[model samples]
Target: MRLTLSNFVNYTSFMKFHYSILCILITFISYSQSVFDQDQVIEKTMSQRWELDDEDKNGTFKLTFYKPIFVLPARWSSNPNELPQSESLENSFTEVQNYDQVEAKFQLSLKTKLIQSFLFGHGDIWLGFTQLANWQVYNDPVSRPFRELNYEPELIVNFPMKVNLFGIDLRMAGLAFNHQSNGRDLPRSRSWNRIMFHAAFEKDNFQLYLKPWIRIESSDKDDNPAISEYIGRMEANAIYNKNKHSIYVIGKNSLDFDKNRGSLEINYLYSVKSNLRLHFQAFTGYGETLIDYNHKQTTLGIGISFIDW
Candidate 1:
């Protein structure tokens, strides 16, 4: 074929028209797929919580809340495990420690993004830590001691995206390597490691989180070989907010019908002032703490919550 000015001009016009159409389609898809809305409470909450939609212009290195921070002055337990024991016979305690039925409880949690836009452009890597403690503050004879402390550290690779099912919006999904332990020596020591898969979804004033994990086996002695049977294989957390009132429900399941075991926790929060809220909590079942992973108990607590308002 021979090149000509007339033919070249016609071909160029056709290509330009198709390019315009492609651009319009891209714009439409982006707009329709958007899951964040500033006016929607749940959407906005999650957006700011995860920094999913550039809601926070601050750098990714800033520390933020990974879990609720709360202190309960009075926590009453229905059944207190007098003899804390582990699956490993050597890790079991022979003597029972003096503990109070009613004690103080608190938790602290924080997270920071270590890397933004790694692996894939949209994925972010974050490091998080949480500590929960049970205090024998009222045990006068025992001389005020910390009963149990659980430390949790996580490395997460989070990916934010937009997907809708029914009326719920799937906001983000991630994979995490989690380690939880009690920094105690000898028979008191307890720990576990897991690789977890997590997802977040929101609808109206409610937000839900799902996490399913698989235990990481180690060659060393297993402190709690039956941890999953008691603590659980998966967890579900739901939060609902309305004005100054918020309610949270956290549940865990072992995923085995033959020997089912799990835990349920309910928390109620009422905002009293700026970032300060009155909190009430109730929990039942196993795995309240690393030392109590196989122990079943029910507890009620009254306290104050900080941040994530």
Candidate 2:
């Protein structure tokens, strides 16, 4: 069943989603140590991950998806993990494909400005959701599927500071209480508390951000994937703007040569009008394991994004 969700801010209010009904009720408290004097433009995206097949209920070679995230930043709210949605906000969902040893996801990202960003360092908080894909361990000659993590609610706390050259903006948060499968019919849940330090710098048309991510996954009964591990993620985005037409190129890499891998994309993001956007792009990279088998994709499309502020 598709769960419902609701918004949880009171300083300025609105509602979306149905997972929570009564509301989380968090008010915006002015920070005396805020680093800015003006509001920044709040950038947000409503997106989904769609795949070709559903996972098999019993143990089999089934295909599934990772979490489909709804990223709403806090110029819209002050609480973490409270991304609200409705049939009206956006209808963007990525298409997913599942293969025995490989899978693919096509992303349709939508953006909006629900709240005006405060200048300097305001609206640094964000909230989102996710469901891990079907990950399995098969040591036999024939490959069969086993359960990894099912689904989980995710939270984010980002402190977007002033962007400057030779300077880094630090952001950190935790992903608490996501679901996992334990052999039985019932599910086991776990939460990961993570803190990351990021260095951000941009020059001309290029933006570079480096993150040193640390993860601490708690165990329901002290198993292995429950310890803390550190991974390095480096992402770079370059944009070319010519009048009303623009291009965006992004490359993301993770130093964790194991389970978690990465991608590189080059696309065009343009404002067709005050309310319309045209997006087109193609990307080729690796998936869960880099360099084992190449991850290839070529998509040509256009969409409207970021209309309300």
lDDT digits (tens) for residues 226-291 of candidate 2: 122211244455545454555666665666567555566566655544323454545545321111
Question: Which residue pairs in candidate 1 collide?
Answer: none
Model 1, range 1-309, lDDT digits (tens) per residue? 777998798679668755874585455334423532323322247877887876553457898778987878799999987898887988899998888899989888999999887775788899999999998877857776788899999999999878998989999999999999999987988999999999999887899999999999877988889999999999999998887788999999999999999999999988765446688999999999988999999999997776442
What is the Å distance of residue 199 in model 2 from its true position?
Answer: 3.4
Model 2 TM-score (2 dp): 0.37
C-alpha lDDT of candidate 1 relative to the true structure: 0.84
* Model 1 CA deviation exceeding 4 Å by range: 1-44
Write down the TM-score for model 1: 0.84
Whole-model lDDT values for every prediction? 0.84, 0.32
